[model samples]
Target chain A: MPPRKPASKDPEPLPRSARKDLTRAKLLQAALTLMGEGRSFTSLGLREIAREAGLVPNAFYRHFRNTDELGLVLVEDVGITLRRLLREARKMDVAPRDMLRRSVSVYLEYVKLNRLQFLFISSERSGGSRILRLAIRNDVTHFTNEMAQDFRIRGLYAQLPTASLQMVCGMIVMTMLAAATDVLDLPPDQPLLEAEMSENFVQQLKIILFGATRLNDALTRS
Target chain B: MPPRKPASKDPEPLPRSARKDLTRAKLLQAALTLMGEGRSFTSLGLREIAREAGLVPNAFYRHFRNTDELGLVLVEDVGITLRRLLREARKMDVAPRDMLRRSVSVYLEYVKLNRLQFLFISSERSGGSRILRLAIRNDVTHFTNEMAQDFRIRGLYAQLPTASLQMVCGMIVMTMLAAATDVLDLPPDQPLLEAEMSENFVQQLKIILFGATRLNDALTRS
Candidate 1:
């Protein structure tokens, strides 16, 4: 007898604030997917992105001023995500080699999860929106500084100077992005087997880290 | 004027074929410049590139279909240059350590000299141009094969398989790009001033080779 009642006429729409955040997040996610597919932000229009997010073109402005602003926000988010991954890895009690391996696993995992944001930052280093480029530099600077502190605390870098550590961090970031983009296979978006690539990635990273460490030791002895 | 030239007039423009090649080269050069400045080809218009090359818009299509075609040509040029650089370096009589050091020097020197071309290829990875992306991959494959041959001849890599050597080559490519990006801010690009960074690069390459060699040796002993 209770089944006779009709469904409610309408469900409530998202609250204005919630809807705004949702729209922004949707746009960013869409951007990440598009960018991951090797599409550059320059070739991407706001309307195209808005359509991808299933929102009207004008509604895009409700979340941000324009695509560039949206990209900057995405870059910052990527930076934060990258930093958090490093921080979490630092807390684990794994062997240094395993820690790096896990770090790379997390890195590849993050890229898979946030492909667009990573692609945006990666592409910007070469062909990104102006705001995205600036954001990348700013974020990488902050990231390098963070690593410098970690290196100092670990005393693994006692012989090397602070700037040296920054250089290593920068090298690592560049290599990471280069490796990620290479494996992603640019436009047409081939799905790389992350598990296999991550294994190779760890080996490469270890080679870099081990080599850096030994070189520092050799110089100290000399 | 000594008996002034009779019927003085401007020389006819370059021959049609000559003009076409000149235009193609100019377009490629302009693409490199813009790409080197971190501009994406997709975002850049044919007119702007034509302007950069000191040509009118219609003159652009005379050379190529679009900027994507121009980009692929530039990628091929880059690969050829790199191949030549390595081939020349391979002919020098130097110790393995010195050879690697010199190879790195050559690489960095090339980047400095051909900054635009190098930057363009690195940044154009994510451009939605199929042919251009394939060109990049072709170059990478060619470079890897060349490096593999070098390792085979050196005997240092005799114990490692061809695939492993290719992996090392990939690492080398990745590291060289990272170094050129100056993302690390490691001194100036001056090879002499960059002794530390350059040394670091060589040391890392050495470690990868040496480490693999040692690992293989240990396995044999076991």
Candidate 2:
């Protein structure tokens, strides 16, 4: 989140793989930087991305075959970012009285910390190339499945059937993505509005969780 | 929904207002057509849209000052379509079993019926111009408020606080929009998949509804 650590600060020559990783990261950052500057992913050209990355155009081919290939890598990064957020949330104290609210706070912080990635996913998830949209959808499904798995592993909503639990997680993920959109668009330096949105977000997730429990109860009774 | 009824079938001279309305509709349709062809709203130019609408560039100004204004009008149309869906859902027999499923069915049908409009909003909502993004967000909020109001008027979720009720509706609206994106992307003639998606949709909405009730109980006890 803090600009990611540089691969190295010393002048000592790094391993070949390390250098490749750094250049790959640079190309990815170049793409995100362009998108951050109001360019849609589809509008980006490989030459410009390479130029932005301070590499020759030929360097672009060392990483991606085309812009769409680069776009897919960005989507993959979004997937990783999402999984990281989930991992962070999993680290929170589940016994806390307001764990949900705390989780929302943590999630918003991560969203802000990784604003460009969230913005990229939010915009592309519903609005861009078919390949990218489907890719984002697949990652979202993965996220929702991981969430459902977490709930089960924690014995939360354990009574719900697998199908119902997944549905509930899907709803939760939808709410989270919607909140991310809000987080990305949030006006800078507006704590009051930010708090209000966070509270609203927590309440929305509560509705899904409680609703899943209620459904499980009804199924058990019937 | 059935392509909208023709204003007249007669050979008589049309009223001036009627002609103006028809031309405006053409311009709106042209914009949608362009977006449906995978063009982002921000990328559309006045000349291209006018040409697409079979009008001179001058006629474009008669309907919209620029493409952004036209985009705003499209957002307005999306609002109307959403409200109409709500109205249709209201007419459903609430006492019947699985009313949520019925509503989702009707809603998905509407989404498919107005595929272009849904596609327009889905893309522009967060992906394009700031103006269009904000406009769509405003309409979505309006749709959420209207949903909350309808619940209140009908005595649904009668016990939840107004703020909580609105938040619940916001979740529900969020789910609906997410489902719309699914609906818009659904492959042609896959009834099995469509039904599966519809069932998933109903389950998601039910979770929110039941969740809201559970929260209301908790709040009351607290």
Residue runs of model 2 more than 4 Å from their true location after superposition: A1-23, A55-62, B1-24, B38-48, B55-63, B219-222
Best by lDDT: 2
Report RMSD (Å) for each prediction in the order shown: 4.7, 6.8
Per-residue lDDT over B61-108 for candidate 1, one digit per residue giving the tens place of the 0 to 100 score: 988898777777778788888788778768774576566777788777
State the DockQ of every prediction. Answer: 0.36, 0.57
- The prediction achieving the highest DockQ against the true structure is 2
Chain A superposition TM-score per model: 0.80, 0.88
- Over all chains combined, what TM-score does candidate 1 have? 0.80
> lDDT (CA) for every model shown?
0.71, 0.85
What local lDDT does model 2 show for residue B139? 93
* Residue A45 in candidate 2, Cα distance off native in Å: 3.9
